[model samples]
Target chain A: MAVLFGGVACLALAGGVGVIASRRPVHSVLALLLVLGSLAVDYLLLDAQFIAVLQLIIYAGAIVVLFVFVIMLLHARSGEVARVPAVLPPAAAIPVCAVFGLMLLVVLTGAAIAPAAVGPAFGTVQEVGRALFSRFLLPFEAASIVLLIGMIGAVVLGKRLPPSPPDAGRPAEGPGEGRSKRRVELR
Target chain B: MSTADLVLVGPELVLTIAAVVVLLQDAWATGGVLEPQTPRPAAVWGSLAAVGLALVWDVGGRRWGPAFGGMYVRDQFTMIADLAALAAAGLGILLSSAYLPRVRLPAGEYHALLLLATVGAMVMAASGSLITLFLGLEILSFSLYVLAAIARRSRRSLEAGLKYLLLGAFATAFFAYGIALIFGATGSIDLREIGAARPSRLLGAGIALLTVGLAFEGALVPFHAWAPDVYEGAPLPVTAFMSVVAKVGAFAGLLRVFPLALAHLAGVWGPMLAAIAVVTMILGNLAALFQTNLKRLLAYSGIAHAGYLMIGVAAGGPAGTWSVLFYLLVYVAMNLGAFGVLLLLARQGMEADRVEDLAGLSGRAPWAAAALVLFLVSLAGLPLTAGFIAKLYLFRAALGAHQPVPALVGVLTSVVSVYYYLRVASAALSGGAPQAVAVLRNRLVGAALVLATAGVLWLGLFPAGFTAAVQQAARQAAAAVR
Candidate 1:
């Protein structure tokens, strides 16, 4: 059991690193899928069957497919230059990251984790549903609004503008500008 | 949930429903296509009516207690915050009505997002549990992010949106991690439960991280790098609305977490917040002095005002709570009114945002120039305006809580702030040849200006009635934790 856990965890870690380190957008999505799949396996190993299935179905299957769709839709080139400027230089970022990691290490090492006993229904779909509908109802309902706002924002920001009039002078710089440029490059 | 639960969140429901209706109405009216130049009055009036109705629910409903398994609360604190947020939303829409069509922004989306953002602030103010608070904060931040970038035609607006989103996401991560740590330490995410649990180093670190997140939202110093740029780059009405709404939401969360929930640990966080307050005031004011852009200047002034409000938060008592509430109400008026005057100067596809834009304003538009003077003076905390009374209450609260140093710094900073605030005022009152900045003659903006001006004067001159009411409410709120 311990070896199985260790192997899956290592796979997940490697997949996470690949997601960030990959040069190609398609490769990054594939790496993300690996991470999600490994996480699901780890959940299954822990006897969280329902959660493991949900993880595979929602994140690995649906969400990753969506990422691929977006990447394809944008025609993201493999060698596209990073347009957004880096906030911190690597010289500064390295030490900051090292310090943060050290702090996390210290905090985690010092803290004691005492796992609480759970009921027989723990990790069951029914139990999770009950909690969602009862004690956590407010946040659950509020999350819908969050999702709704996300949809609205995606439409408002991502929608292509109608063809500009000849006399419109300079065209308005919408989010679609970069996408159209990329499409032209592809063609 | 029960009918009572729904009633408790009546204002939020009204606004949410209104947002959906406005969005649908927009889709129906525009047929999902950008059209000829007429501005949709329906969106503006619908949003105004929604805000007005929400205000009625907030005041008239008056069902004060916890709901949603103690996740949400409707009390005097929430009421005061709702009033401030609703006021900002109403005035923000009024200010945006004329500018929308001129810029060809979809009025429906703008008004819907604005209404939703207002609901987010109201939720944050009414949150009883940490989960509710975080959710409310996300809702508020998300809507504002979109609204900030709604003017996609402008590269500056898009840049502002991206910057705001990245920094804001970082802040939210800090906040969420802090909540996790607090829950781990106390084994509960409820504010009252956390208060009852004994404090530990974990809890302390969590609280500090939580303060960082709230301070970022409030635009307090050190966490305020994005405020000036975002304020300058976002559309004028967005800047105006967000300036007040963000502060209202942040300060409300601060009041809940520090004073009401964690009052017993005041010794731990009080001095920490006081130090932040002092620096925020000094840095915010000093920074404002160098800014030539009116939007950026107001942004810095906002940071300084956050410091003043923090003094009240650090005080941690009934006096502190009510003073913060009163100051927020006054801030909505003064800040929005100042932005409203600037909104009038917005012409076809460009905002008259520079300090020079207000030059010769007295010659061109006397009422606007005069109104700008009133708002700036109020912001400078001069007597006969609500800003003075607000500062007075905050300083007294600090002194009453035995924090004389912050009070002294507050006074000194207000003096320095006057220099900058009056510079803008004087430019409008008496400057060289007035630039041909076309001031949009819209009655909606004029009515908003009148309403905000009345609120400022009423709160300043005859503050007795509101003061008494807030004091009573503050006492009740403070008693709830005990």
Candidate 2:
């Protein structure tokens, strides 16, 4: 069991590196899938079958598909790398990452773990569902609200503005207005 | 889900229903596509009515205690936070009523999102568990992100939204990891249970990370890089609403976690927080001095106010908790009033955001100028205004807790803040070139200004009644934790 866990963890780590190292957007997405898939396998190995399935169905299946679709729609090419300047140059980024990695390693390694005794039904669907409806009901309801807001926000931010009526009497051409107009013309 | 639990969440339910109804009404009105130049008054009025109903439910309802299996509590702390959030929402809607149509923003989404955000803040204040707290924070942050970018026709607004979203997501990640670490250390996610658990280094680290998240939302220094630009870029009413609502939520969460939940660990986190408060107060004030934009200036001022509120949290007693609550209530008035003045001065799709925009304002519009001066002085913690009383309570709380340095820093920072606050006030009062800036003569905005000015004066002059009530509430809240 330990060997399997170790092998899957290494696979996940390798996939994670590929996710950042891949030059092509689509290839990067494929690397993300590999990472997510290995994480799901790790969850399964831990006896969290429901969560493992969810990890695959949600992150690997749906979200990755969405990412690929967006990449395709945007027609992202390998040569058309990020035109925006990097927020942190490699000189700054590398040392920052290294320090954060070191701190996390120290914190995790220094912590003493005393695993709690679990019931026979731990990680089972019934137990999870019961807890969700009873003890965690408020959080479950609140999560729905968060999801609802996400949907509303997507529509509000993404929807194309309808053409302005001639008599709208808008005084100035704002920055977003001009860009959106150009998009409409291009379409 | 018993009726009792439903009653406890009555205000949130009303606002949620109202948000959906407003969205549906907008969809029906516009035939599923946003129509440019259309002003939807129904959405605005409906949202205002919902906020009023929530306020009524929040204040008048007698049901108060742990509900939803102790996931939520409807105690005095929640009530104070709810009042601040609801007050901000009501005033925000009033401020938006005129500005929305002028800016060509869809009224339905704007009001709907604002209501939901208020619900989020209330949820955070009421949360008895970390899960509810994180969920509530997400709801609030998500709603504000879209609201910030709702002015899609403005590039600056979009940029502000993107920056806020990226940085806010990073902060949220920190917050979630902190929760995980806390659960790992304590073996429970419930606040009361965690408080009873033994403190460890892991818990300390978790608390620090949690503070980072809340401080980011509060716009405390070192985590406040996004504030000035976001405030300057977003629509005026949004800047106004978020300035108060975010602080109300963040500080309330801080109050709950530091003073109420982890009261036993005050020795661990208090001094660290005090140091943060000192730095935030000094840096926020110094930054405000250089900002020529009204929105950016107010943003820095908001950060400084967060530092003062933090003094109360670091103090960690009934005095500290209630002082923070009182300051939030007062902030709803003074901060929103300052932004409301700017909102009124906005003209034909252009924001009068510059300090120079208010030139000769006392000569042209005496009432608005006077109102602006009153809000500014109150914000500067001057005498005869709510800001002074609020700051006094915070400083007293800090000193009562025997943390003299933060209190002293707060006092000195107020002196430094006066220069910038008075600079804007002087700009409005001084006679200068005839500015083309016209104050929008909207009755709704006028009504909001009147309400805010009255609140500032009432809280300042006769702070006795409110302070007494807050004291009682604070005592009850502390009793619950103990």
Candidate 3:
């Protein structure tokens, strides 16, 4: 079981790196989706089914969709100025790979020892609901507040502007209208 | 669940109700009625009521208790922190009362978002477990993403919002993974359970990853890149909200997790934090010297302050926790006052955040200049200001824990920081002719300055009373983790 989980983690990490490195925006989004999905699977294997589902729903489905939509809206296609110039790519790649290598090394060397037993934990929907509403009530309330604020912001941003101050009740004046009218009368 | 628990959450409930009402009002009052041109006093009043209720709940709930099983806990710490956040939001609203009319942002949604974000910060301060922590973080982050870009017409605001959102989401991913791994190791998501569990290699790695993620959210070290850009890009009041309230929430969460959940792996995480602290302080201060943009400079200043706060985290005992809590209190006042001044100084489309723009401020707006000087001096950790007492308490805490290295580094950094703080103050008092620039003198703005300045001075002068309060909060905070 430990070995299998390790394999899954490895796969997720590799996929995540690939996604981050990919030049194609669509491909990158798909890769991110895979990473999130794979992580959910890993979470389930770790006996956190609820969080797994959340990862899938919130990250893979919602966030990724937002990313794709925004990318499309902006028309930021891949392969157009996709890759950085020579100086920057190597500079970026080297440190990234080093960090990746270090993380992998830490995982490989670190103890992956399986615990003696896995309990019949609160891995079910009912248990999660109980946990969320009871012990996690403050955060639950906070989440509601967050959603409320997001809605309010959407409304505020979406609201159309009011017309300009009723034109301050001033008579319409064209460019140099007053001076021109006086000059015309004198003429 | 006691009736008191319900009361403890009363402020949030009120805010929640107001949010719904505002949403309904928006739904009905479409186009012109709810538009920026038509300012709705009713909506504004509703938001004020919500803020008032949140404050009432914050003050009303003085004791600690578990709610919803053990997922959420409320205590003096939560109350104090929530009060701080609510106060900042309230002042932000007051600042915006005048600022919005001048900038043409007469929409009520601004107040609603501000209240909602405060709610998130409150939850974050009170969270007891990983699940609760993540939820609170998301609540804060998502709202901020929108708030950062509230001025949709400005390209800079849009760009900043996008950068913050993308980076923030990425950080969240890292955080979620850390949570998953910790669950895998302990088979429990509760912080106390994780705190009591013996350390394993997997758990240590998980702790490290979690620290990294939290540090980024806290705007610490290498992960701090987004703060300045986002702070600079966002609107003045929004920037003020983010600077103070966000830092408080993040630190609250960090104090809960690092010292409690991963206490066993301190050897692994502690040294890394200390290194990050050294680097963040040096880099943040050095970078501030070169910035011409006042907002960007404040952003760097914030980074440096984050480093100082992390020293308290490094201390990690009772003294350290209390010291951190105390510093955070001081931080809220000093930062909010600074941002309040910026809000006043900045006219529509003209960001007075540039360092040079502040020249001759002492002559133009003496009261505003005086307030700025107080805040800047406090930030510099000068004697007779809250910043000095805050740092003194922090160092005492570090020394108490026998963590001489970080304490020493902190003192050195504080010394280096004095120069930049003084530079800003000196500029505010110097060269530009008084007649040349128009000083901001809006009544609402003047009110904000008075409130912020009083808080900073009060905290600086009467730190003992505040420290006592923080001590009680620190005890509860540490206990929640344990």
Candidate 4:
């Protein structure tokens, strides 16, 4: 058990560092996928099987796909100037180190004195399902509402207009009115 | 969820279904491979019916207690807050009924988004858990984002939408991080459990961040960079809806969580919030004093009002919470009417957003001019109006809670706000060209304006009965909090 924990923890740490150390955006994103994938494995180790599955499908699958697509859409290229910095400047590191130090202090002081061992049912699918269906139902439904609103918002905001007979709209153009007319970028 | 639990969230469920129906029906009717028809009468009526039903269910005499394992609850506080939110939506719909076409926006999507936003606000108001509160806030914020940008050809509207979305998300991050900290400290997501938590760095940090998030929504100053621009840019009805409903939703959650869950830690936090209230009131009023744009002025005023409401929270007791409720209700009527009157200017192909546009409104549209003055007076907290009563109660509550400095700040800021409120009134009533922009005549808008005015005057003239109802609800709020 100790060996397994040490190996996975080291792998996750390496992946986190690699995510920032990589010169290429693509490499950075790939390293992020690694971190997420290993994080899912950690959830699995902790017996949060449902969350582990969600992590795999949602974060590793959907979110990373979105990231890759965005990179592709932006036509990302790895060149000397285009490359992301592998390390932060001293100025940036000050705040970053400060935050890290604070978190360490908090974790040290507020650490759980003892964590009670729970049955295997604690994070199992059936147990989670029971709790969600009964006690957590309102929030469950609220989450769905949030998702539905997200879907509607995305479609409404993303819809494009056909800028036909553009001359006819000329008379209505006031100061800064050029933006009111929609222009498709990719097309 | 059991049927019994379902009963508690009945209004939210009805609104959810109604919103979806409105969205689908509007899309089917208006957006297809054919020439579009005006969004059907049935769609708007259906949505209105849903809102009415929600209002009824909210204020209805049903047993109130925790539901969904205490994550969501129906209580007097939630009910009163929901009632105010629903009233704002109702007025918003009425205003949109007339204003949307003039602005060249679709009604179907607008009304649907508005209903969905109301549902979000209601959820936020009623949530017993932080997770629920966060979800509700997201729901509200997203719908408003879409609603703000619905003016497809309006750059200002789109800008407003983008600004609101970016700033709102930032605030949400603060809120989520705070919730995580609180959960880490207390090992629970429930606000009631959070109230019982021992003081610690984790809890203090959590409460501070949580206050930041709520302050953003409430438009308390220093966190209020988004309000002026967003208010200036969005469609007037959307502005009115956002101004009132967002505050009510956020304040309801603040009232619930702070006065209960974090009441234990108020010794450290209360003074901090009171200072915020002082700054918010002073800065908000001072900003409003110079604003020429009517909507922007109202936005600053909205921030100032947030200061008053935070006084209720800082006051940290039953009196404070109930005063917040009373203030929110009064705020809805006056603020909604003020924005609704601005919709009258849309008939001229001009957004009546400017103080200059309101000049000579008295001669041009007597009733609108009168209504605007009434709302402004109420907003200024003048005697014999709802605003005065609301402020009086709020200050009394503030002193009762031993937050004397904030109470004093509240009184002084009311005096400062009077100048700007009267400025708007004078701009409207004073001399200029009497050439009237033909006002759009919609039965619903006219009806809503009348209702707002009646609510304002009735509550002012006859405070006895309303005060009694507020007292009853305050008792319930106390019981639920305890």
Candidate 5:
């Protein structure tokens, strides 16, 4: 069990390092996918099977795909220089990882953890449903409102601008000058 | 879900419904918000009416509880903060109606989105559960992101929106991670339970990260890079709305959580917050000294005020908490009023943003020039305006709570800020050549300034009644502590 945990942890760390270090946005997105996937695996190992599956389905599948779609939509030029070096020397990474591992050890061991706090029924859909509908009902409903507002705002921003005189659009192409001009025109 | 929950959430529910009504009405209205034939006043009226309705539910009142299984609460602080948030939203709508057409933004959608943001802020003011707080914060954030760019034709507007979206999402992620860690530590999301939980290193780290997220929303230094540009680039009314509403919402939530439940761990977070307050004040004021544009100057001033408000948060008690609320009332009025005066000065051909535009203001428009001076003096925290009394009470609270250094910094920074604020005021005094064209004076905006000016003097000159009322509210909010 310990060996499997160590392997998964190493993979997760490596995936994280790839995310920031990658030169391409697409590669960074893929790195994010890897890290998220490894995190799901970690969740499964901890027996929060529902969270593990949800994390994979929601974050790895849906969110990452959405990110890819947005990147494509923007048509941003590719292959920008990496802001930081692609990778650090093993000497540096090793000590940083050691410090991180030490912090984890302290958090995991210094705090008391209850052994077998729940049974196999834990993390089931029905259990989550019960909790959501009962104790967490207000927040659950509030989340819906947040999502609804986000949808409306997205539409407001994304909708096609109403057709105006062709000459009106040309001068407004550059933002800084357009801003001052529009500021006055909005009168 | 339950009647009690309904009662606790009644104000936010009304605001949300009003938002939807405004949006639907916008779609149904003829010609849309900008066309010459379209009547765009419904959304603005509806938004204001909604604020009035919400205030009717709890105006000058107080209630307390762990609503919805400890997910929400109502108290004096919530009442004070919610009223302030609603007032800011109402004023924004009033100020935007005439300005929107001048800028060619669709009136209906802009008002609807502004209402939605208000709902979010109201939620933030009352949230007792961490989940609810996150949702509330996001609702406010998403709406503002769109509103910042509502003037879609402007490159700067779009850039401001995009920058806000990116930086805001980054801040939200930090906040979410902090929530996750906090959940891990307490094994529960109930704020009271989390407070009762032990002070683990994990919880401490979680709180520090959470403060960073909230700090960004409040525009504290280091997290405030977005303010100057975004404020200058976005529409003046939108900038005014954001500066007032966002600070009210974010600081209200910060006060609710940190001072009430997390006070036990003050040893962990207090000093860190105090350090943040000092740096934020110094940087914000010093930077304001160099600004050439009035919008950018006010943005920096907003940042400095955030720092002063934080002094109360660092103090962490009933006196400190209520003092912050009083100061927010003062801030909402003065900040928006300053922008209101600017909005009136806007011309069909010029934005009136440059410092030189105000140079001959006294000669060009005496009333506006006077109003501008009133707002600037108040902003400078001089006596005879609410800003002075606000500073007085705020720093005193900080001192009463034993945070002497931050309070002292607040005093010094106000002194530094006076130099720049006065420079703007002097433009009105210099009375340069008279304007070629008459200044545009939208009645609604003019009324907003007059009202704000009245509020500033009333609060400063005769603060006794309002102070007592807020003190009563603060005393009730303290019940959450035990």
Candidate 6:
């Protein structure tokens, strides 16, 4: 069990590192998808099925797909620079991960983990559901509202552009035609 | 569910309702006018009305705590901070009125989001429970995510919004993980419970992570990469609002949550915060020195100011909390006034964000130039401006707690910040070239400036009333400590 848990954690860490280090935007996004999926698996390993499912549904399925679609739509010419400039990426990323790793280490070292109870107990779907519908109801509702807002926002901001002008249907043959086409397009 | 609970949360409810109404109004205004009608400034009026209602609620009460099943609380400190946040929102609306119309961005959603964000900040300040805190933080952050990219046609705006969203979600995850740890440690999410509980290892780790999350939101160094891009990309007024009001909410949350739950673990977290404060201040100021863009410079300045405010948090005492409240109030006033000028100068469809954009501003627009001077001086912590007194008091409080390192870093950053602050001032004062046609011609904006400038000058010169109110609020916050 420990080995399984540790392997899942290692896979998550590697996936995350790949997401950060990958040179291609598409590859980085794919890596992110993996990392997010790995996180859900980790949640399952920890016995939090509800959280694992929510993680899959919300982050991995919805958000990552949206990211990929946007990346595809906003694609540059095939060989264009896909990575952010140095001092920009590392300056933002390294400290965040370092602090996260250190903090996780602290939490793990400090926490005296409860010995595994072999039966279904805490962190099960039933326990999570009970908590969600009762003690955590308010936060759950609040989160739902937040998610709703995010959905509405995405729709509003991501309005697809209308079909291009009729003039755009035809290619300009040369500079003179292009100038006339531009003028026609402006009108 | 008595009326008193509702009354205690009157300001928050009023602002929330106003946000909804404003959003509805915006939808109505722009929905039927299919041909992109001239921007009807519904956002501006709604923002003003919302702020007015918030002020009424703020002035209506000066009492404290556990008002609604321990969800919300209100006191003098919160009252003052709420007023400041609302006032900043109001100015932001006024500035955006003049600013957005030029760019032809829709205004209603913008205004509604601003009000909701303010409500979130105020709620955060009044939060007595973890549920309220989380709700308030999400409200503030989500609204900001949209507002940061209101000019969606601009690539910079889209990029800023995306970056803020990514980092913000990451920060929220950290916050949630910390909350989970704390719940595991104490079996309760109430701030009062967390405060009274002793420093178990789980709780300590929770506090550390929570601090990190809040620090990131607050834009302290090492966690502040998103700030410059977002601030520079956002509308000048929205950027100003993000810098000031959002910081108010974040600090209020930190001030209340930290001292209450983690005071016993100060040995663990205090030095961590102090180091963060130092790095944030120095990095913010040093980075600002090389910026040619006015908005980017102010973004860095905002970061430095955040570091200064963190001094009070590092102190981890009642006095420290009071000083933070006072500084936030002053900061709101000064930053709003500064952005007012930027809004004034920002020509439509032009990058009015660069330092060169301000060349000879004084010769062309004396009133705006003077307002800019006042704001710049205050930002530099010059005497007779509110920032100076706020810093003095905050440093004194930190020293009182024997945390001199943050104070020292704060002073050094303050000195370093003076150069950039004055460079902008001198740019405005140079009067070599004719300024672009000024955009801030509206009387409402003028009124905002008058009010904000008065608050800055008055708070700097005579902060007794503000400080006294803050002290009372600090007392109430500490009441939950035991």
Please identify which of the two predictions, 4 or 5, would achieve the higher DockQ against the true structure.
5
TM-score (0 to 1) for chain B of model 6 = 0.96
- DockQ for each numbered candidate: 0.29, 0.42, 0.22, 0.32, 0.35, 0.17
At residue B171, candidate 6 shows an lDDT of 88
- Tell me each candidate's TM-score: 0.92, 0.95, 0.85, 0.90, 0.91, 0.83
* Per-residue lDDT of model 6, residues B28-48, tens digit only: 867722113366656677668
- Tens-place lDDT per residue, model 3, A1-187, is 8888888888788788777677767777888887888889888887888888888899988999999997776665552434422233776679767865777687789777676574577567878888666665566666666666666667655655443432435321111111122312110
Candidate 4 regions with alpha-carbon error over 4 angstroms: A1-28, A76-117, A164-187, B32-39, B434-438
lDDT of 4 by residue, B1-482 (tens): 57887788989888889988887887777762111224357666888899999888878746688888889878877888888989998888887776665444666667788998999889988888998898888888889888877665567777888999999997899889899888877788898877776777777667777887888988997799999888877877888899999998889888878875666666787888889899999999999998877888999999999999989888877788788888898999999999888877742344757777788888877998899999999999999999999999989988887889998888888998999899889988997843544555678888889999998998778877767776677678667656
Winner by lDDT between candidate 5 and candidate 1? 1
* Clash count, one per candidate: 0, 0, 8, 1, 7, 2
Per-residue CA lDDT of candidate 3, range B1-482, in tens? 56766765676678767766765675466443432544555666677777877787678756568665667778787777787777877777766665564554534566667777777777777777787788878777777888887765455666678899899987888788888878877777788888888777667666766776777777898899899888887877888888887887888888778765566666666677777877888888888888877788888999999988888887776677778788887888888888787666653235566677788888877888889999999998999999999999888876776677777888887888888888989999998743434566677667777888888889888878888888888777676666
* Candidate with best TM-score: 2
Q: Mind giving the per-residue lDDT tens digits that candidate 2 earns over B1-482?
A: 78899999999999999999999999888876643466788998899899999999998885789999999999977887899999999999998887777667777888889999999999989989888888989989999999998877677788788999999998998899889988888888898898888887777777777888888999987789899878777888999999999999999889889899898888888999999899999989998999977777898998899899899999988899999999999999999998888877753347887788898888877898999999999999999899999999999999999999999999999999999999999999996834567766889999999999999999999999989878988898888877
Query: Mind sharing the TM-score for model 4?
Result: 0.90
Q: How good is model 2 by TM-score? A: 0.95
Winner by TM-score between candidate 3 and candidate 1: 1
Alpha-carbon runs more than 4 Å astray in model 1: A1-47, A72-106, A109-113, A165-187, B347-349, B432-435
Which 10 consecutive positions of candidate 2 chain B have the poorest summed lDDT? Answer: B30-39
- Which scores greater on lDDT, model 2 or model 6? 2
The residue ranges of model 3 lying beyond 4 angstroms of the native Cα positions read A1-90, A115-187, B1-4, B23-35, B38-44, B263-267, B432-436, B480-482
lDDT of each: 0.87, 0.86, 0.74, 0.81, 0.80, 0.77
Which structure is stronger by TM-score: 3 or 5?
Answer: 5
